[model samples]
Target: MDSSDREVRDVNNILFGGFTELFCLFLFLVSAFFPNSLLAGDLVEQWTGKHTRIAWVQDQGNGLDTYGRSPDLMLYGYDSQDGRGARPLLTQKSNFFKPLITP
Candidate 1:
């Protein structure tokens, strides 16, 4: 209500904002310094296979079309990098070393 009260509120807001900015900077620094090498460890274990599938499908919208870009430009997804042909790899029970997983 009063100028003094307003000033105090402003000070509190500034302090809170500064703290938030500093916290964000600290988080950015931490993430930048520390690599997430272990984040894909589980997936890496699954990918440790005796065979790697090669994908072959339609144009991934990387080419030029009559309009401008290909209408088939692949939409982003969990398997965006993989083509339609990669379904077999995902559907298969053991994409890894079959001998070890099966026997």
Candidate 2:
């Protein structure tokens, strides 16, 4: 209606939208840590498919440059590029999307 009313509405909209987004993000991060133990065997099998093990590698040090120094278990049959046998390297990138350039 009035200018002041419109401004109030805009502010409320922004606040509510930001809160909703932050809430959703929090839920997503929390869910990531909480494994679905109730998941059925068939469902889990379907998602896992041929791959049985999923290995996650985290950077021990800070900074992007530390990525090179990160532990590489490729020699242990956990490499996507040089992956051998039944289990492949289960990096975060490979799990979600196919790598553009793999060795």
Candidate 3:
């Protein structure tokens, strides 16, 4: 194409790219500024008598031998009369706790 046509194409490309970037930035800003609608309703409804489970693995230090650590899963439930209580449901000791890597 001619010089003018190339310049026009370049300008169009730059404009389109800038528009896309601005649109994405606007969407990000909107989401950041607005509280999450899904979680904004009620605090009591979110945690009242609800059960939460967490799965994790631990590590142990031993010499000349190794052991397989079991998967630890814990369930947490909140009760109004139970007061604030925290407990470690499961624990294991293994080297896998640090430098997590997949086999």
Candidate 2's C-alpha runs over 4 A off are 1-42, 70-103
lDDT of each: 0.35, 0.36, 0.35
Best by TM-score: 2
Score candidate 2 by lDDT. Answer: 0.36
Return the top candidate by lDDT: 2
Give the alpha carbon lDDT tens digit for every residue of 10-100 in model 3: 8867867676456335433433443343232222225433432222232223332222233232322222222222223334333343232
How are the candidates ranked when ordered by lDDT, highest leading? 2, 3, 1
Deviation of model 2 at 94, angstroms:
22
Task: Give TM-scores for every candidate, taking all chains together and pairing residue i with residue i.
Answer: 0.23, 0.26, 0.22
- lDDT of model 3 at position 55: 25
| Model 2: per-residue Cα lDDT over 1-103, one tens digit each | 6797688668867867686456334433433443333232233345435323323233333534222334432211222122232233444321222123222
Worst 10 residues of 2 by lDDT: 74-83
Stronger candidate by lDDT (1 vs 2): 2
What is the Cα-based lDDT of residue 51 in candidate 3? 31
